[model samples]
Target: MNKLFAFFLAMLLPVVLFAQTPKMGEFTQNEIDLKEISYEPGASAVFLVASGESRFFSNILETNYFYRIKILTEAGKEYADIPIGYFAGSTNVEVVSAIKAQITTYTNGVPEVTTLGKESIFQVDLGNGYKEFRISFPNAQVGSILEFSFKKADKNIEFLDGWSFQRSVPVLFSNYQITMIPQLEYKMIGQGENFYHRSEKSEGNGVYSWTLRDLYSLKGEPYMKNYQDYVDKVEFQLSRYQTAATTSGPEWTDHLNTWEKLGDELIEYYSVRGFYRTNPLEREVLSLDLSKGSQKDKAEIAYYYIRDNFINEGEDLIYTKQTLPQLLKSKKGAPGELMLAYMGILKSQGIECNPVLIGSKGHGRSDIVPFPFLNQFDEILLLVKLDGNLQFLDLSDPLAPFGYVDLDKHVKGGLFLEKNASKLIPIDIRHNSNKLVFSNIKLDTETGDLVIENTIRNYFYEGLASAHLVEILEKNDKPLEELFSEKYDALEIRNVKVDDLLEDKNMYNISFESVLKNAMSEDLIIFNPLQISKFATNPFTQEFRVFPVDFEYAFNETYTANLVIPEGYELDDYPTNESITIPGSPIGFSYSTENLGEIFKITARLEVKNPLIPSSSYGDLKFFMESVSSKLTAPVILKRISIP
Candidate 1:
């Protein structure tokens, strides 16, 4: 029996040592094994194994990530090259190893491996305090295996590390292990509803691990905001710290324990008081005669002065390198810096104003959490107390008026940093956010054509949308009239007149004259009076939505078409009207027509009373948009009673 056991031990000793060997930062042969992978159905590539290990040693924390992917189809070739980004200020990322192997039937299914050298790796410096390390695997093709490992080390103890198990492609197995020294305390914030498989006991040693398997690819839908908001991920924030000699470390201050604390920290960081150290725009503010008018009126003059003179460069929540003097002279600054300048100018005029930090529409809403973090907010606006009433100003938006805050800036809540104390306050702006379009059409029996005059009035958010649309058209070098004609081939715009296009006002009006060709056919005249319909098809095409559909603000759009029927033609049939209303949701769509003798009137209204619709009511919103689309497609058929 002893001789038989000795023989088995000798055979397995080599395999056990190789498996248990410490390859913490190396790409091993097993990782690049190109054996057949039972990939998930419809998956272009599969992550055979993905693991991340984070260890805190001495003063620096190092995170090593390893990934092995098997390419199954042509679409998976994109996975052969990947870019990894890290904050350049604190972290240094290094590619430890990368290897690629291809298995073929040649020589009885032998595998040929190729190691990626340092020449295949490139480091790119992306402005805005970030850098990316791009790595490409050589000789990677279908049925090939690619494996790479990278390590990022940082001495900063901010505890901002986050891990995401899901990606654009399916992951077969993902495991993350974190080991920390008992000195650091962190708050684990998790998103998504997936639970990780973890060990029973590891808290005593300051070690934790999570494993996830068979995670499907994250599907993107229309109108979706930042993908990070919905991805299944876990993040850690350093709340406080402890040490061996002292119970709590000196660097572990409760600076962000409350919203007020967070506000105070930001005020100190941005030097809010320093912004008003000098009154650079005093001459301009004095010439406006703001003292005689109400505070609201005074704010309008100041808002327009900033909006017209300077251009916002789209950066948010941070100050620009240029000073106020430089910014005012150059007429250009980032959005946050512009708002800060506005506040400084307003404060010099004895106006009560404070800065408010909130997330913008494109940035998505802040997470509902107890603690306060600067990353939670994106944009900065001002809060003005006028005549004992609170007013918000989004001076960054050129078209937005003083009283009319940009709907995107209304993040429901903001940290209002006041003089003595700070608090979390709700942002509510009183402005009409609607759009009205009235079209009058007259059919010419002699020319077989129709002349339609469209009058469009946009208010608040609606005006912003109109301004953005025109800006995009101009940026792309496309004429507004030409784009309109292209969108509807039958319609040709003759003239267009716009109002308040160059002003900061609540409403803007546009009127245009267009002609529709072939309105009068040989025997029948077919025309779609609602030719200016914005929606051709439902925007919500996803079968299931896991995230809420955020419209940012409530808006109402009304379209009225007054058509004069051509002589000797009677209406054979009109499109059936549609009215859809969900009991709980605030979205509504209605279509109706009224026959007023010679002038046949058709009115369609799409009113969204609620700015946001939860995923639970996605079906209702989809159905409403679908109904409007169908009604817009069906034309009004006219039959000729007698040929003149």
Candidate 2:
């Protein structure tokens, strides 16, 4: 009987060890109960244990990372699904271990477990550059606890995205550990919360760890920067390396310590493969009646030559290996290559133009640290100095206006890569943007019906965004008429005319007509004079504010309406003219009504004078918007005149 028992114990030991949870604690049936985590209010799911560790192999020069997550949440099951992306080259990363996931549930005081099969996993090929591994938890349900683990091996040290402790969901216990060899030196940078509960340093073993508990979920806010920028996370930047007695690596400070050094490095990096050295196609381009134009005119000519001739590939990179001659011959190149060629052309013509690097809006701000970090910048433009003024140009977009960049690319500051030295420059959008809306309302004296005709014009950056919205609507097979009807159900719309779809213009115009309902009564006629007000409700609805408001750019929206009074009706009451401005903020709104005997005039203007609003001004901003919304939805009451 003793010998038989020993044999069974040996077989089951391996199974029991493999099923153990992460270092936070051992998994139990009690963890599957939803009531265990009911204290977390407004959380979709609660992470029971979130732990990960990375191991670096010095002999093989590779890093292996393993992570495990145990979660319990029937309400927010979306967190149970995971996606891991890997590059598709020979020198890229790959998943070396199989994923293990299972769901545990308790019923009638009995615990039941269901393991996921290989069929639940899927791989997607992302076209030459990358691929994705996706897995879905099996039997995922409320009151079910899920546990999953996976491992990834990567040879490229640059692919280390680091670890994030705070996520969109609340975490009960979070921990991270990393063990590295003596050859690699890393600069550690952290964001969000500063304090950690546990910090352990290895004893001559090159291991580091951090632990935190009961982290709150990151709330979603409107008009804020990228989500990744606000998460509590730790990242590593490989600053140097050593082998035996030799040391060699990137001198982060020497290369990017100052604005001048950063600019010089950028110019040198982009000028590789003799790009922008000499433009063989410059003579041919200049010969087309553009050789004799002024400096500004010639610059425009060169820009169109590149914009119309080359097809823009939307890859975001600082440098390209494709030579200028090859790009010219093929008439196809990435955005970087095309912009490089444009710079080369401008240089060939003796025009003064420098490359300006900026961070895209969705990519977050570029002001993280003064260190030389190339990953912060994702787009490049040209800063042309003509007649003692700077003109910004973006040739990557074929449909972009002549002297303006994309709305998202109009960042506040950028690094200017000058030939001799580099410097930081500020960009403003108020110089090239404007929005105007006009409405003409005619009231039928006999029928008490309102016919509204509206004309809207958007220029420059505002125009680009408006055009994109129209394009998306058309692409999704959604008509503007249908959308307008859905938004204003009390109106019947017709004669929707939009112009400048095929032409290249600095601005776009949209005109439409709508007949409003509930404007007629036996003794009273009531209607809203501002028919084209865009903001029907305030978007800043959160009770507590933490993040700064980033509008991306300063903008002005103006509405002017001309309402004709019916012969038998007289104005009983109207919205009072009022103007309000925050004490020190750049936000302001004004509404005015004029009682012309036959025609009533109404004007409303909302102006965001600055692109950024600090959190200190949140209360005033919210109150101002609330007042604007209330006034916009108020009705203008009119009473029938008795026979005199």
Judged by lDDT, which candidate is best? 1
lDDT digits (tens) for residues 377-429 of candidate 1: 77788888877777787766665655656566766677788645877777776
TM-scores, each model vs. reference: 0.82, 0.78
- Least accurate 10 contiguous residues by lDDT in model 1: 13-22
List lDDT for all candidates, in order. 0.67, 0.66
How displaced is residue 520 in candidate 1, in Å? 2.6
